[model samples]
Target: MEATYCAGVLSRGKLPVSNLRKSDHGFQRLTSQRKAIASVSCHLSNGLGESSCKSHGFHGGSYHGGAVGKGKDPILQTRCSAGVSMYGESFLESHSHATEDKIGVLLLNLGGPETLHDVQPFLFNLFADPDIIRLPRLFRFLQWPLAKLISVLRAPKSKEGYAAIGGGSPLRKITDEQAHALKMALEAKNMPVNIYVGMRYWYPFTEEAVQQIKRDKITRLVVLPLYPQFSISTTGSSIRVLQNIFREDACLSRLPVAIIQSWYQREGYVRSMADLIAKELERFPKPEEVMVFFSAHGVPVSYVEDAGDPYKDQMEECIYLIMQELKARGINNDHTLAYQSRVGPVQWLKPYTDEVLVELGQRGVKSLLAVPVSFVSEHIETLEEIDIEYKELALESGIKNWGRVPALNCTSSFITDLADAVIEALPSAKAMTNSEGTSEEMDNDPLRYLVKMFFGSVLAFILLLSPKMVLAFRNHLF
Candidate 1:
């Protein structure tokens, strides 16, 4: 599933653009070479967003990826850069009687196709997202067209993987259960807030959830991305969508909102993860000797080194914390971390999961346990990729026994912790209005953006037109 998801739906290559203003360029479709160019461009990294996404709020820099500036106003990356700022120095006192208000907890996640038929459109949505694929400004107008082309081509393989994993993605069903569980958990705490699931790519899209928030007259809102760790590609993407929507709607614009940027550092989450890993380790003959392999989803290295994405940093720290919990419980074991589900034409976070499994097997590791640290629910990447593909590779390479730690779908402790996070963020519930000085980082320098777009267009033109590149593209998809 990891290989297919990336090679099919998320398969993208970066290219440059040309003569790029904010206008549509043309009606040029070369069918004779369409397959070649599309397939090749689908996986190669044109590195277009490298400049636009620079700093991503790192170092001594106050701004982070799509987020409000750090320090006193540290908040989610919101591009809601319009209207008057209604918030004050501290949002905790900005609104009184929040307890009496109708509170809504929005859980943002990555959506998946529910059935084989939904694959194409889901792929289209995934690729159409500039946050996901990062197209050049010159080719910005081609976003939809490019999305359609790639989705149609990749649908066959994507559907096959979905079919293998029971003909669809269980992400929706699991996410819904999580929402139900979170609601119940919050209610148990005597702080009941309506829980809504907003998937980034598929059904129950964030836009749909926003509309419901309007209809339900929800007063206080808390955005809790299902992602335990923050990443511009995940939490930032969803928040940006909310930022865009909230910026336009008057009622939403003024709504009191608090966003839990990340919760991996939370104690409950760390304990829950340790618990899962410990239990899974017991399945092996010598639990103490079992190799604890953590396979996390991968992102382009540029997202970290260049864009200042904290995903790798947070992931490492999360692992450390979880390991500390395990050690405290007297369950210390050999462990390693690797990245999976890489896409595009660039380098992703290394050591690739596949290569690591082979290396471990060659090292004569007999018993191994795979822990999916980044994901909280069982999805294709877990059910198919790690469980099936990696497991098979492990046995063939040399290892004999293998087991995977289950996702914290509705684990009691995890849910309860999530509830606590929402309650804790209420005091800081901020309205994403312009006066907060949060949206400036999102725009960057307009001149720099334009120049990047121009160069991007030129590079894209050259890449798609090259003969060798065309052949490589054809071999990738066709």
Candidate 2:
């Protein structure tokens, strides 16, 4: 019955689909969007388009499932069974509750230019985000023109970077693999899940993913970004996009959603980093002598100081947790954390990765193992900057041995943990607070500290003055 309802919902509309085909310059943007209707037809018809038919299992001439509104045609109802089909497959099923609840996991990431041509547009998208480039209300109108001009100016260097890294970024490929691995891992645990990769600033944009999710008629959604640590310009931007899109879509607005803001300190995640570091350490003659250099992507310092961004604080804690895990395994090596990918002559998080590498070389540190601690997969930063640019610099600075820890793309333990994190994040109710899952150590901002103290004092006063109002106030805590 659930499978039948899902088929009906998918078949009712011709889904405006975007192809995931590889292009030399990036995704091909066709004028007329292709429909995935044929795929749905194939699923329901079992290789026969409207000819091969079964009982369909629908009753009362209606789908009568969650996808359909009350008093609407039951035929329009949507239901997918768990473990019944993979995402993008014909059957949409959930493993939870007799497959009544369909789960959609949207994997978010900062997409890179697929080719040289895509560099400018990608940059435009990046800079256009209000979180990335803050503007006063009076100057808001200049955002587009400024973004355009900046993209045009930055395109050459950006193109060069992409060209050096095989003329594009493999972020899409890596993200796709991550999605598949996560889906399979969840399925193994009897959790029906379909993974969708939604890149900010590229093909399969958040908007595209939102349309796809609506068409899929997902009952529940998990917005799990690829960035392990949350940042305003990355995860927060994506979340805002989702929130705005869902607000406009009636169907999506009613859907239950659980968002995992960050999972940098997950035990499995930290262990995965530790394992990679250990493996890389084996390449050196004396592993203990090698520095475990953690290179994380940087953000403008203003983001932290003015905008109340907790990115750096979270990153520092993430590094600390990974070191703790490494220590538990009895592997101790000198370690340091530095920020990379600073742009546009603004102050960013420090110490800078490049500066640190040069200093280490000058200090006669011949052996070092570089770690892309914040990056889950290899991209321009890791492949071109770290491997090519940084490596060349290290060699010129007299560093004899230099190696980088491999990214945790589709690592079994890491994927398993990703699945677990999503499952744990899904709430029995409509929403769950991120503070419940995120480590308290990440909340180090003075503003939050002040807020907590103020609230504590207020609560005490209320308790002393009016004990009866306590229950009323308790309802507003969340």
Candidate 3:
């Protein structure tokens, strides 16, 4: 039933713009229902707003779906009569109240080319980002020309890649499915939400999303990047661009925005990943014998070394946590993490996925399950780079069997998890980070390292003393 609901949403991905506009009424209905339950206003990172969101309901405010709650916000306390049966009895019944505060969720991702002609320009937009190609401030002026040159040189090969993957990338389709699923999930939970998709460098770009958000008159905004693990080049670049645009406009500059930078550690996200792996493992005759290979998208090494980007660190930790979750599920298969999609003459995060595959093949690890860890939706990276190119490489490298985990696009559990993250972020969303290192404070803190080391030693000692007790210790630590 959940799969059916997800399928319904996926089908909507191809809907024309006119049809999508028609769906606004459904979102407004959701907003009106949610406004009845909660009246609390936006909670600012700097400080709480002087006037509550509830105050606008009675003030003849021009906001869409008017203020939701009058005195107090009731998130899930009141049950409405509207809910899908697939969500079970726990979902709140939908109700209506006057509201002007419409919750707008902006989904951010690196948009892909829809045709071969778009490949070069997409590549240019990607390489043009200073985050992708680091340049000293004095030399930054060269980025545009350099990006142009690289895109021209790389376009033919990239065009072939898209050609193999049905002549385009399915990223936008998958992302739209995710957006629709999230909207349903939020509405089921009795929250007013309208989801907007914003691709960084292609059609429906960030600027376009902002324009739509403004046109719709969204009262409060929640920015959720599709990247689970935060990276300076990906999430950081998107958020920074968005905040800069918001600052330029008087209305948007004053609009309250909540930011969910990353959710790599979220339990539901980990579980959804584990579930995908488990399903993939079932395809193998000997599931336990197959090795788990996590292939994350790579970034220039200098981004981490010189710019203090914590992406590499976050990727490592994310892999560890996912493995831990798999272990908890009693799947103790050997696993390896490698980076993929490297570009240019410069070194990227290593060991490269292709290199790792070659080494594994030489070592006679015959069966393998490749997981695309950095991406949540199907794109050229997964369709061409992993499934096509790497699969052929793996099979030719003497691997008897090979498989790749499907991207988690609109999976019910993952969508529910996203809805929770959005709801949690709305109340205390901070402005996007200004500097690259700002997001890495907790990761770089000396005390954090000391505590981790202390706990690591303790766990090791406990394992040596009593293997059984390690289970208890693990439970406590988690």
Best by lDDT: 1
Worst 10 residues of 2 by lDDT: 1-10
The number of the candidate with the highest TM-score is: 1
lDDT by residue for model 2 (410-443), tens: 9999999888777655542253122122111334
Model 2's alpha-carbon lDDT is: 0.61
Cα TM-score of candidate 1: 0.77
Candidate 2 is scored at a TM of 0.70
lDDT per residue as tens, model 3, 277-304: 9999999999999988888887766666
Candidate 1, superposed: residue stretches over 4 Å from native: 1-97, 435-461, 471-478
Q: Against the unseen true structure, what C-alpha lDDT does each candidate score?
A: 0.66, 0.61, 0.63
> Which residue segments of model 3 deviate by more than 4 Å?
1-100, 430-478
319-401 in candidate 1: lDDT tens per residue?
A: 66677678778987878888888754556777788888899888899988999888999988999888888999999989898
Off-target runs (Cα >4 Å) in candidate 2 are: 1-99, 428-478
Better-scoring candidate (lDDT), 2 or 3: 3
In Å, residue 327's CA in model 1 sits off its true spot by 0.6
TM-score of each: 0.77, 0.70, 0.71
Window of ten residues with lowest summed lDDT in model 3: 1-10
